[model samples]
Target: MAQPTAAESWSGGNEPMKAEYGKLMMWFFLVSDALTFTGFLTAYGFMRFGHEATWPIAEDVFTHFPGIEGDQPLLYVAFMTFVLIMSSVTMVIAVNAGHQLKKTAVAWWMIATIVGGFIFVGSQAWEWYHFIIGDKGGIELADGRVLKVAEAQTGEVLSLSQLVDGEAGHASNHLEKFSTGEVKTAFEANEGLVLQSPGKGHAQLTRTESLRLMQNAQVVQGANMKHNEYGQGQFANFFFFITGFHGFHVFSGVIFNIIIFYNVLLGTYERRKSYLMVEKVGLYWHFVDLVWVFVFTFFYLV
Candidate 1:
């Protein structure tokens, strides 16, 4: 019996795909993941708009970089976004190299993508630390309203320790929790720190108003499942859950890329004379990057 000709094989099978099982499976996974993210984001949108009065501002919540500081809002997150997008570009280059069987170029491009993933993942970790530990510590009132001290002259937000005389540690360290009486005393003694009130503007508190508002205040550190320096607890919950979920995906992609990079180093694809695996992985890498664009817009830019 004679085998089918090359032309016949190329033109047949479900129209084109001869054995693109991996690509098909990857698409299925991406579609399912998209649905999950859509549901979560929808819930977030509803909760956010429902309680618009108490929702935290994205810019203020995620404003930290590393050594360099001073209220450089959204700078670090923007860099993370850029790194992730560049990684997707490198993935495209890697897939192209794989198609051409340029083993060296493929390996190098994969390495670049891996490095970008690391930077993104690490940036996410730092963000989590800052968020969980909080920056400007606030005082929670009886009605669940959180109020932070701001400079009356410069409008600079001050942590509770600054206004309240507590044996506080560094912003990154465990805070020395202050009582309501202490906070009230501090505010009464120092006429510098003002109050941050919503709706009336971020800095719309008189010296006397600030002193009166601290009548029933309790110290609150950064943010957690229960409390947040920003606003409502839901804000912190959603931030942690949504961003943490995306971070896990990026981490998984890093591991997958590492496995493929290891295979590239060992000449596995070269021996097989096919770069199909690299192309499949590239599809996943691009999908991850695409999802992040939406997340960034929804959470940060919006």
Candidate 2:
């Protein structure tokens, strides 16, 4: 009973447990996924910079709109971006409500997030359809070059319908050799559409150049996995890969959100005395939204 023992530090409990085990694991997964995305974007950057010339113009390539006529420029993508951003905000509200143990608020915010995700996914699918269908069809030349039929003065690209007297569907194979009166007649009929060629970073053409190039050429239309009407095969390849990957992420996030939404509705979090799952999923949703912004800026806007 001599000297009183000095009190030791309280090291019995885990002090650094701000998040639960599942939530912490989710964070680790997200970090790894982010690295994967960074790698893909890096590869795309290398390809884009390496093949500076003949790269397709994003604006000219993605000019289609929904339920509206005429070229809407980047209107659709802009709307998608807005929707995704709003979803991120809703996720924030959801996580905040979860922190406060408010089941009703969390459910509503999660539903809003789910709705936004559905709209985004649907829009992307529609965009993919139009991309596959293509806008104004063009031909790929024998020399691995693309020739677009565009307005002589305005430099506006023309659809196959406009060029071939309202021919709706795609006409002629890319490899089929065709050079004679048909092209000449097309030239005569559509005086406005000149043979346009792609430049270093943009699609450029002149009436004189087009008139000369159309002399010996084959006819083709649209784009595919192997070919692109705009220019360079890489554009289509990258477009499909990156967008499809992001779409998959969105679809997965939507599924997770639906599960969480139902759980909230059923009072699962309340019974468990914790709503941390919502917060964890919200982290994932926020990460997805951030990735989309980077993709939009680099691939579309830039």
Candidate 3:
């Protein structure tokens, strides 16, 4: 056995290992991860493709804003989209700081990333709550026409003409007195909606109860014909599953960022003299951001 010369031991001196070790490993990991994500995305596409007709139009389904009325289209989700993109920008900055060996800067930028993650998660929770507890209840009729239950105490869900004509039925005279502002905000149309239980231990309505409501023809699904209360079944299913999956990712990202923050404070990277740990974490954070970009496009944009 003989000791190799310095030059022979050097990577460039012998048969090249192809790419630099760190970069090669990163690329390999990225390729595998890309495939994993592709599996999820492809699955989503297959499900959506088969049920296109039964999927709600994204804009019509999610356009709930204060002071908006009658199914007017809105772009609030575009704002959220921008916020998530900007968070990606901040994460990139943190990655660059690690390259420059700026530990304090890395700590601060990592904290910002966590804050952005928190904001995004909070927004998602708000969206979920709004969707689950929408003001109107949806009833699927035997003939398949949906009946919408409004906040009106009067049992009658009357048309504007019927209300003025005094022909609205028993629950019709309750006079909820919702102004345009209130109605627009309180009664978001087409979102996945569930009826609130009357009180504790009250049995929640099943499909049977919902069908019964529709059988009586008590209420038109929407007075203004703005939107049917029953969102396309496929849309509601995808909406919950996709957003819930992304939220889980965001939660995990926050936890990961916290660990990195502690590492930064303790000067671990400085002792190691390489910020590869930060780079690795950055890759993970960017992957999260990338997943959200697709989610926004599929769930909110299209």
Best candidate, TM-score = 1
What's the ranking of the predictions by TM-score, best on top? 1, 2, 3
User: For residues 216-270, could you state the per-residue lDDT of candidate 3 as single tens digits?
Assistant: 4323232222334434444455667677777887788788888988998999988
lDDT of 1 by residue, 97-149 (tens): 99999999999999999999999999999888888877767778778877667
Identify the runs in model 1 with alpha carbons over 4 angstroms from their true place: 1-13, 16-19, 151-156, 165-179, 190-194, 198-213
> Candidate 1: global Cα-lDDT?
0.81
- The global C-alpha lDDT for each of the candidates, from Candidate 1 onward, is 0.81, 0.78, 0.58
Positional deviation of 102 in candidate 2, in angstroms? Answer: 1.1
Task: Tell me how many residue pairs clash in candidate 2.
Answer: 0
Ten-residue stretch with the least lDDT total in model 3: 194-203
Is 2 or 3 the stronger prediction by TM-score? 2
lDDT of 2 by residue, 143-176 (tens): 7777677776777666655555554333322123
* TM-score per candidate: 0.85, 0.84, 0.63
The best candidate by lDDT is 1
Runs of candidate 2 with Cα error greater than 4 angstroms are 1-17, 152-154, 166-185, 188-194, 199-216
